[model samples]
Target: MKASKVLITGVSGFIGEALVFRLLVDKKFIPVAAARRATKFQGLCPVVSLDLNAPEAFPAFDDVSVVIHAAARVHVMNETASDALSEFRKVNVDGTLHLAKKAAESGVKRFIFISSIKVNGESTPPGKPFLADDVPAPMDPYGVSKREAEDALKQLGSETGMEVVIVRPPLVYGPGVKANFLSMLRWLSRGVPLPLGAIHNQRSLVALENLVDFIVTCINHPDAANETFLVSDGYDLSTTQLLRQLAAALGKKCRLLPIPQRCIIIVATLLKQKAVAQRICGSLQVDINKAHELLGWVPPVSIELAMRRTVDHYQDKQTK
Candidate 1:
C-alpha cells in the first residue's frame, strides 16, 4: 500500500511522539509533525508550528489525508487559572473546531480525535462500565471541553462531508508516561506502604502502544467513519492488583495495608484530596466491544509487557 501523509498534532506529547515513531517504523504513513515547538521532529518529517490557543494560526493542510488530533488543554492537578472552563474551551473546543474546519476545507478525509474517558463521567459502579454510545456527562473543565470538541467535530463532519472518529480512552500509560501514572510508579519504587490493599475498585487503562495502533487503524478504516469508540486494554485491575503488578515490574516489594475504603475517602476529604482518593479507589472502566465489532481492532500489546517497558525506561532515566 502507498503511504499517506498524516498531519499529527501534539507531536511532542507522549502519545503523539509514540505515534510518530510507530508511523515511521511501519513505513505506511508519512507523519507531518505539528506542535508549539515542532523542531523535535524536524529531521524525521515535515514540521509545522501549531498553537491551539491561536485558532486562526494554521498551516497548509494540502495533501494531508488524515489528521490525528492529540493536542489539548490537558487536565491540571492544581489549576491556577481564574476561569478553568474558558481556558480549556479556548484550546480543546475553539482551537479544535478551527483546525477541523481548515482541514475540511483543505480536503482532508478523516479526523481522529483523542478524547478522554472523563467525558463519560468520573466513575462507574462495580460491574458497569462506560460505553461509547452512553450519554456524555463530563465532570470537569477539561472533560467538558473535550465533549464540546467532539460535538463540534461531528457537526462539522456532517456539514462538510469529512469523516470524524472520536476515541475515548481511559488512563493511558507506557514509556514516557507522566502525571498520576508516573507518580504511582515513583511511590511504588520507593516502597511506600500505601493503605490501598483493601480497595477492590476496578479501573481500565490503555497502553500507549495499543492506543497508537488503534488510532492508526482508525485513520483509514471505512467502518470507523463518523463513529465514537471507547478503547482500553480489555482488562480491568483493582488498585491492589495494579500496585502489585507495578511493583513486580519495578523489581520492588509491594507494601500495602488493608485500610478501609471509607476511611481513605474520609481522610482524603479532610485533606482536600478527595479527588485524588476517588481516582485511586473509584471504578472507571470502558467497554471496547464497539471498536472490536466495527474495526476488528484489538490491543496488540499486553499490560504486563507494557509495564515492563515502562519500568525499563523509568529505571534507565533514573540512572542517567
Candidate 2:
C-alpha cells in the first residue's frame, strides 16, 4: 500500500514546518510543501509555491489525500494596512475558500484547517474555559477573519463531499517559537525582573510537537470529520508559573516582583501597549475535553519537556 499524500500549506512557517517534519518522521504520509516563497526542504519533498495573497494561484491537488491548510495572514500587532479587516479577509477568508474549493473539486478526502484560539475570543473568564462549541466572539479583525474562514470552510465541506476538520490552538511553544514566548525566554535568561508574580489568571498553551501530533490524528480519524476542536497541553499555568518554568528551563533564577496586575495594566495603557498588557495579564483557557472524548487525543509532550526544548533551541541559536 502506498502512503497517503498530504499537502501542507505554509510549509515554510513554524507550525507548518513542524507538522511536515512530524509526518516525515512517522513515515505515514508523502508530505508536499507549499508556501508563498521558496523554501529549501533539502530535496526531502516536492515543494509548491502557492501564495495565499494571490487569489488564483492554486496548487494542483493531484494525488493529494489530505490538505492541511496552515497558511494564513496572522495577526499583526501594529497593523499599517489601510483596512486591516479587508486585508485579513483577503488572505485568510477568501484565499482559504478558494483553496478549499479546488481541494474539494480535486477529490481531496479531508481538509484540515489550522485555526487560532482567537476565533473563540481573546480572553476567557477564570474557571470558564472556552469550549469548542462556544459561540464565536472574535474581538479583533484577525480573529473575525479566522471565524469567517472557518464558517466558509464548513459550508464548502457540506456542499462538496470533502471532510473538514478544524483545530483551534492557543499560544504554541517549543523549539523555534518566536514572539511573546521567545521574549519571555530571553527576559528570564537575562535575569530581567518581571512584574508578573501576582498574576493568577490561567492561560492554556500547546507545545508545537503536541499540536502537530493532534493534526496528524485529524488527518484520517473518522471522528475528526466536520468537527471543531480546541486543543492544549491539558495544563493551565499562571503568568508567574510560566515565568518560573522558563527560568528553570534556562537554568536562571526567577526574578518576579509581586506587582499588582492593575498597576501593570495602567502603565501599559499609558504606554499605548494595553493589548500587550492584556495578553500577559488576562486568562485564555481552552477546554480540550471535546478532543479527548471524540478523538481520544492527548498532548504527548509535557510542559517541562516542551520548555526545555524551547530553551535549548534558543541557547543553540544564540551560540551560533
lDDT (tens digit, per residue) of candidate 1 on 86-141: 99998899999999999999999999999999899999998899999999999999
Model 2 off-target regions past 4 Å?
Answer: none
lDDT of 2 by residue, 1-320 (tens): 89999999988888999988888889989999998777867488888888876757777888999999999999978899999999999989999998998899899999999999999999989999999999999999999999999999999999998999999999999899988788888889899988889999999999998899999999999999999999999999999999988898899999999999999999999999999999999999999999999999988989899889999999999999
TM-score of each: 0.98, 0.98
- Candidate 1: regions farther than 4 A off: none
RMSD of each candidate relative to the true structure? 1.0, 1.0
| Alpha carbon deviation, residue 195, candidate 1 (Å) | 0.9
**Would you give me the overall lDDT of model 2?**
0.92
Predicted structure with the largest lDDT when compared to the true one = 1
